[model samples]
Target: MIQLHDKQFVPFISAKEINFAIEKMVSQIEDDFFDETPIFIGVLNGSFMVVSDFLKLYKKPCEVSFIKLASYEGTESTESVKQLIGLNQDLTGRTVIVLEDIIDTGNTLEELKKLFKSQNVKHFKIATLFFKPDAFKKDLKIDYVGIRIPNKFIVGFGLDYDGLGRNLPEVYQLKEE
Candidate 1:
């Protein structure tokens, strides 16, 4: 069990389980991108662990970059995304993959898609480690998803609560009060 803010204690998604999920996600990506050397764009902070593990399993040649976006305060969704750090690479005519730790409202992903389009990227794909189907508010297709989880505040594997617990090896849910 792990302890979180508000004196919450809950079991986390085990590291072994996370590894299994990553393996599956990587296999799917490899099959779809077998012929192309695509550019992988990892959403910062929360996605760092997932992206790192995924890249290690990626057999093909590819480049990696990061873009930072923020939209959460504590366990609540703000429904707004702010790009804290911008992409520095030129994405024109490039096959790009956007990696996210979790997808809830879809606002962040939608905004990213528009941004990439404006930069003239030829193709864009999404790969998220976690997805909340019930909380999804926009109609955007996700190319790859690791797991479908209920709407909850999660921490670990780079996901955090108030800048804590991000380094936990597995994912954890906040305990109810």
Candidate 2:
């Protein structure tokens, strides 16, 4: 159990579950791109933990880059995408896999996809540790998803509320009010 910004939360997903998911995702990624060297574009801050664990488990040659986008204010997403940091890579004729911590509304992912398309990337795919199918409103296709969770305000494992609780090893869901 943990508390963030006056909201109490209970354990939602354990670290063991996260590790198992990571292993499965890594195996699939390795098999899918064994013949090609792809560029992994990590969605920064939130995806730092997942990206690190994934790369460690994925024994293949790949390039890595990071892009930071912010859409959250406190526990709620503002739904207005803002680019706090941009991708510095050329992104020309490269196979890019966007790694994200979670996909909720899909607005940020959609915006990123559009931007990457304009940059002339040869290919693009989205990989997320968690996906909220009920909460997603966009019609975009997520290439890979570790787990599906309900629309709950969660924290830990690189997900945060008010910029806290990201260091926790497992995930927790906010308690009902």
TM-score of each: 0.96, 0.97
Least well predicted 10-residue stretch by lDDT in candidate 2: 114-123
Query: In model 1, which regions exceed 4 Å deviation?
Result: none
Report the lDDT tens digits of candidate 2 across residue range 1-177: 677777899999999999999898888888888888889989878999999999998888998999999898788879899988898879788889999999999988988887787888777888999999999999889999999999988899999888899999999998987
Best by TM-score: 2
Given candidate 2, what's the lDDT at residue 52?
A: 92
Stretches off by above 4 angstroms in model 2 are none
Q: How many backbone clashes does candidate 1 have?
A: 0
Candidate 2 TM-score over all chains jointly? 0.97
Per-model CA lDDT versus the true structure = 0.88, 0.89
